[model samples]
Target: MSAEAVSALGLLGRVELPGVAGSICTARRYVRGVLRRSGQRDTYDAELLVSELVSNAVRHSESGRAGGLVTVAVANCGESVQIAVTDSGSATCAPRIPPGQDEGAEGGRGLWLVRELSLSWGWHEGAAGRIVWFRLARR
Candidate 1:
């Protein structure tokens, strides 16, 4: 993490959720509230990004085996906000843009939207699991 990244955003809130479908929505709202109060105008984008990250953790990771918790952390820098969603699974799969777009498709495209909307984004391997993080500049 860059000093610029850390200094800009304060620790707004941290949440731990069971790896379940419903938890994704809960995490999304939690993060959205943090950003909204931190003066973030792009609530929709933030919500979508948080949803995608949490959804991935819940659906892809092996649930109940060793148990898992989806951790959502929001930081508000003066100029931008950073959100990190961490999971307790070692799945090293990185998010990517889905090739081609089908209007009828029901999956993919989360990371694509994150890249398009966020000013900066990346992931890091942590001891507990992987952390997928994104930053949006205040507009």
Candidate 2:
């Protein structure tokens, strides 16, 4: 885990990772590390959810560029954990429960997975960029 993960206190943990495809794994590792250090249980699903969100940011948003950035904020807010990924996306496209994707479709299931796994999810524009967030209840 990086130093920021520990320093960004007040809501469990937070980390800012590069907005690139390769950074997805790093983000996941950071999530796992924070959860473990904080003694939060059942991180597998949270890890998966973070993976999907980061993947979407890298693939569809401007954050994938060389100098682009993505910020992942994780917070343990009582019975549930809140995770948010802010990217340098151009448009403020809100995430939705996507319609049934085609069998032949190459991609487009990331948000769908988030919808299915998270207790609740949403997106909004922020000063930095677009933010996609989700929450999962502790089991």
Candidate 3:
């Protein structure tokens, strides 16, 4: 969904996490806790995608800098669940997948993995910042 179109329908929960390595763990835990409360058993892909997205926000967006934060919104999308990560805008960068994968590189597989694991995913820059989102079909 577009950054401005972040849906509130069936919203399960949301959390604003500090842009730090530690926040990745927090994001995962938050997702797990929320999903568990909703009785979602297959959380593997959701957890992994959330980690990847949150990590990218921390590394590439302005979120990683001091005082910066990432906002993660989780919601139910009928047959699937939606997860969106929003970070402070970065003038030099926006979300994208490399034309080719460099398996030998130390990083850069985040969005590609998101594409593979989620049912639908896209990103957009908004008035406030950037929002990257994905939906995993519920099992």
Candidate 4:
């Protein structure tokens, strides 16, 4: 399915996870199960993309506040699936590919993998939080 179709379907489920690393795998599994039940063959790829987005939110956003929330939303339109992760952070840093020498580093490759795997991905600031989202074709 095409991404444009998925966006038109709107969000299927929206979940909030605490700012903890363990929550990331749980969120990925939840998204995978949803896509799988929907007969999406690209469930694994969608899980991967969601993992990147959720991990970034958990790692970068400030936690412990009453309003701190990491939100995950999934949607499908028969042709494609879209996943978005939002956090209550105003930080302006954007994901980027590191230089050649940094390529061999131990970390900082999540967004790069998302770019390589997803049909399309981007980020924007919403009224309540910042959202990073990715879309995949449904096969």
Candidate number achieving the greatest lDDT relative to the actual structure: 3
Query: Model 1: per-residue lDDT, tens digit, 23-67?
Result: 878987897777777667668888888998888878766532346
- Global lDDT for candidate 4? 0.74
Model 4 lowest lDDT segment of ten: 1-10
**On residues 11-102, what C-alpha lDDT tens digit does candidate 3 reach at each position?**
78889999998999899999988888988998888889999989999999899999989988888877889998989968998889998898
Q: Please report the candidate that would top TM-score against the real structure.
A: 3
State the lDDT of candidate 2 residue by residue for 7-38, as single tens digits: 45346766788877888999899988877777
TM-score of each: 0.81, 0.85, 0.92, 0.82
lDDT per residue, candidate 4, 6-114, as tens digits? 3577667767888778778988888987777777766778887788777777777653244466878788745777787878764556556555537667878888888
List where candidate 1 sits over 4 angstroms from the true fold.
Answer: 1-9, 63-66, 100-104
- Our tally of clashes for model 3 stands at 0
Worst ten-residue run, lDDT, model 1?
A: 1-10
lDDT for 118 (candidate 3)? 91
Residue 5 local lDDT, model 1: 46
lDDT of each: 0.75, 0.79, 0.87, 0.74
Ranking by lDDT: 3, 2, 1, 4
Candidate 3 lDDT for residue 105 = 86
